[model samples]
Structure formats: structure tokens, C-alpha cells
Target: MDKLLSIVIPSYNAEKFLDNVLGELVKCHNLNRLDIMVINDGSTDQTAEIGQKYQDSYPGSVRLISKENGGYGSTINTGIAQANGRYFKVVDADDWLDSKNLDRFVGLLKRTETDLILTPFWAFNDKNHHKHIPEIKPDDISWGQKYYLKEQGICPVPSMHTYTLRTKLLQENEIQLDEHAYYVDIEYILYPIPYVKTFEFVNIPLYNYRVNQDNQSISMTNMRKNQQQHSLVVDHVNSYIKEHADGLNPNQQELMVNRLSRMIATQLKIIDLAPIQMATKHELSSFYRKVKDKYYFEPKDINLPMRWLIKSRFNLFPVIHYLAILKMQLVHY
Candidate 1:
């Protein structure tokens, strides 16, 4: 029998969380419509072994693919290629879905025939994280306005794992992951918005996104490559906005500039503060120059310290970073 849904989990050193996540997923009572694929992206640990075990235990329902490390984009592309289900979802190895809401989401997609179904998610802040907030209102929202109202609790971060996209829509649009580490969620979700025939947002938080100190997310660490990836993501988004600007009216354009500025500023912040080596400073500077002209907000608009960091990237960065570190040490001591 053909499957109704294909859940793709890209795993690499996810042994700590893979077992529990898969365990919860298989326990779904109405899994008759669901199929699973775990792409073991060169796991140096027992992730592949555990995935193989699940494949053995669940026979037809689960399958594992072993491949050399090709980053997340390749893993997702491989999973999409192998999926035979009518709909596809990309679930990160670290995150898990709420069993109760997962069923509801799938059922809604099946019945409503929407091109995409988006559900809200909670961010588990490993660094003094706060309580989860709900975003959906009864009022109808256009796809473009979602970002501007994020601060007012109306905008949502796409839980790439939580969304259920019609397989045909993805295949038709040829929407795939990019060579980015941090903003794959943004890129995938944003690229599909202009083409979506219909979209529905469920207020229920169906996924728990863990933001731990040890996590590889950009905000958690200061890796130079992550910073570069973010810069590339910003450029991609800018191009999208430019290409589709005609679709947005005046007010929407202003809102877009505001949202895009805030987003670009955040990415620049990562690049400016990253503990990057002097050798890679030019890449960061080059990216900053490319997007610097496009932002609605200028350097003076930002807070003083951030302004200093962005304006003085080449020379004063090391001095500022060291002083900030010293200041923190003094306070802690």
C-alpha cells in the first residue's frame, strides 16, 4: 500500500536524542498512513546502529540509509528522493513532535487539501529560556506579513520539522535545501510561500525546539562558517524580496523593510561578534558591504556597542571583544 506521509530524519551524532524521538514517533497509534526514513549522514557514533535497529524492529515502516557526511542539505535531498509518500516532512534529529498534535496536523492536511500546514513551536532555551508563546489568531494572514508581526506575537518561526507540505508542491517547485547551516528553515519556508495555493496555521505548539548551550545553532556558538552561512542566507532573502516586491503593496513593503532590516542586523551581529580568525575577516567584511546598502535601518539606528562593532569590524573588533570578555570576568570574580 502507498504511504500517506514520509517523515525524514537527518542524523549525525544524534545518538543522544534519536532513540527517544524515534520511539515516540513509532508509538503513534494511527501510523498506518505514516512511513519513516532516517538518513544516517556519516554518524561517527551509534546513531546508524540504533537507526538500523529501528529498521529491523519496524520492518516495513522504517528504513535507514548510510552515506558519507554531505551536510544537512544533502541528507534532506536524499530523504526526499527516497520518499514515496504523498506528503513529506523534515524532522531534525534533535527535535521531536507532540504525538497528540502531530495526528491532528496530519489529519487537517489530509482533509483540508492545503498546500502547506504550519504549526507553532516552543523554543527550549538552554540559556535561561522562557515559556512558550502562541501566535495564531482567528484573523486571516498573508504569508508576507508573518515576519513583521513576529514581535507582536503574530509572526512564527517555521518548524521545518512541524510543517507538512504536499509532496507534489515541493516536487513541482523543486524546492530544496541550500548550502547554509543556520537559515535552511527560513530559506525553505520563504521560497515556498509565493507558490503556495493555500496555507493554514494551527496555534498549538506541536514541536519542542531545544536551544542548548552546546547546540550548533548560530546564536549558541561563534563559528566563522556559521556566520558566513547566515550572511549568504540574508543575501538570498533580499533577492527574493526584490523579485517579488510587486506582489506587496506600500504598507507591506515598509513592513518588509522593517522585518528584513531587523533580520539582516541580527545576522550582521553574529558576524561582527564571532571569534573568527584574522584570515577570514575579509569574507565577513565583504558580506557586510553587500547587504549594508540595502538595510532600511542604518548604523546610528542600532545601539551604541553594536554600532561600534559593525562600523569598526576590521581594526577595533579584537580590542572590543577582549574588553567585553575582561569586563565579564571582573563582574563574575
Candidate 2:
């Protein structure tokens, strides 16, 4: 029998948290309907052992794929290739799903054929045990209604946690992400947009995203260390938009542009917070030139700081960099 949902957990040296993640999944009522693929990306720790233990216990639902260390994107690509389920989701090894809502979420997937499914997710802080939901869903949209993307005025881009794409859609489109790269989560979100004509929003918070880990990629220190990878992702997104945006319907085009604009703003902020180095300044200059040359459509609602940087031709970068440092210190303090 075909499983209803494929949950791919990409793990690397995650022995500390893999137990909790898989433990939560085993609590779901519809275990038979869930195809859990735990991709152990060459963990030097006990990650593979834990995964094998679970697969031994729950042979029907849990399968472990032990492969060499490919980055996060490669695990996802492998999952897509091997998926036996109708719908697909990627859950990080450090994160777990809301098992309480799994049954309902699975039931919905069993019935609907929407190209994309969106659900609210909790941003959990492990240090303080605080959790909150970000308002990524648009307020104007009705929950649980399947709407065509071309008809919807504007839609917010779903984060990786919120997205559940059709397995067939991903495989059929050959939607491969950049291997051995940080920040390819943005690519996972963007590559499917042109094909995603229908989407449904579910209000249930299905994904519990663990945050505040120092080693996490989104952390300031790691982001600064891997700024070049982030820049590479930004370049890929810009190229994608330049090639594909024109072919989309007006509403879809607006949605793509909105997502691109936000990404540009984020890249600028990353550059601002980075140490004042010649390389950082060069990245800033290169980014502006790329945006100017590639983005034919005027991005909507450019933020104040970004506007200032652009207007001044980025000469005020030192001021912005210092201000960003002060803001970070104040937040941490």
C-alpha cells in the first residue's frame, strides 16, 4: 500500500536530537500512512545507529539511508528520488513534528491534491524553552481553501517548515537543489513556484522548528562564516527570476517578485552585519549591480535602510555596519 506522506529527516551528527524527533513521529496515530525516511548524511556520531534502531523497531514506517556526507540539499534530493508516498515534507534532524496534529494533517493529504500545502510552524528556542508562531500566512486568505495561485492577489512565500509539496510534482519537474551549499532552503522554496498553481493553507502548526542553536546555519556567526554561500544562493534566485518571471501570470509574477525582494533585503542585511572587510564591500557592490541588471520589475516596498544604501550607492555601508552591530548587541544583552 502507498503511504500518504513522506517525512524526510536529514541528519548529520544528530544523535543528541534524533531520538526526540523520531520518538515524536512514533507517537502519531497514522504511522502506517507515514513513510519516514531518515537520511543519515555520513554522521561520525551515533546518528546511523539510532536510525537503524528505529528502523528495526518500526520496519514498516522507518527506513534509514546511510550515504556519504552530502549537504542538506542532497539528502532532500535523495528523498525525492526514493519517496514512496503521495506528499513529501523535509524535517531537520534537530526538529520534530507536532505529533498531536499528524493525524489530521495526514487525513487532509489523503483527500486533497493541492500542488502545495502550507501550515503554520512553531519557532522553538531550545535555550529558554520558548516557542512562538511567525505570521507567515496572509491574513486575507481563508484557511483550508484551495486557491489557484494565478487568481490569488499576492501570497507569502512559505518557509521550508511550512511547505509540503506533492512528491510527484517534485520528481516530475526535476527540482534539484544546489548540493554542498548553505542557504539552499530558499532554492527549495523558489524552484517550485512556477509549477505551483494551487495551494491550501492549514492553520495547524505541524512543524516544530528548533532555533537558538549556535551551530545552526541561520545563526549570525555561521551565516557570516558562510556569507559566500548565501551570496551564491542569492545569485541563483536572481537568475531564476530573470528567466522565469516573465512567463508567469501577473499574480504569480507579483508573488515571485515579492519573494525575491525580501531575499535581496536579507542579503543586504547579512552584508551589513558582516565585519567591515574589503570582500564584504565588494559583495555589496556586486549584489547591487546584479539586481540592477537582472531585475526588470521594480521590487515592491523596499525597506528604508536598503533604500538609503541604494540611493547613496552603498557609501554609507560603514554607518549601516556599525548600526547593525549595535542592534545585535542590544538584542543579545
Best-performing candidate as measured by TM-score: 2
Per-residue alpha-carbon lDDT of candidate 2 for residues 1-333, written as tens digits (9 for 90 to 100): 779999999998999999999999999999999999999999999999999999999999999999999999999999999999999999999999999898889988879999999998998977888889888778788998999988885465768899999999999989988889998998888788888889888888899988777787866777678888887887887788777866788776777677777777767878878778777778888877877777633545457777787777788888888876666544421
- The true-structure Cα RMSD of candidate 1 reads 6.0
After TM-score superposition, the amount by which residue 10's alpha carbon in candidate 2 deviates from its true location, in angstroms, is 0.7
lDDT tens digits by residue: candidate 1, 178-292: 7426566666656655555555565656676665445456433553447667667667777876877777544434434554565665665555455757744674577567767
Q: How does each model score on TM-score?
A: 0.73, 0.93
Regions more than 4 Å wrong, model 1? 125-162, 180-182, 223-225, 240-262, 274-289, 292-333
What does candidate 2 score on TM?
A: 0.93
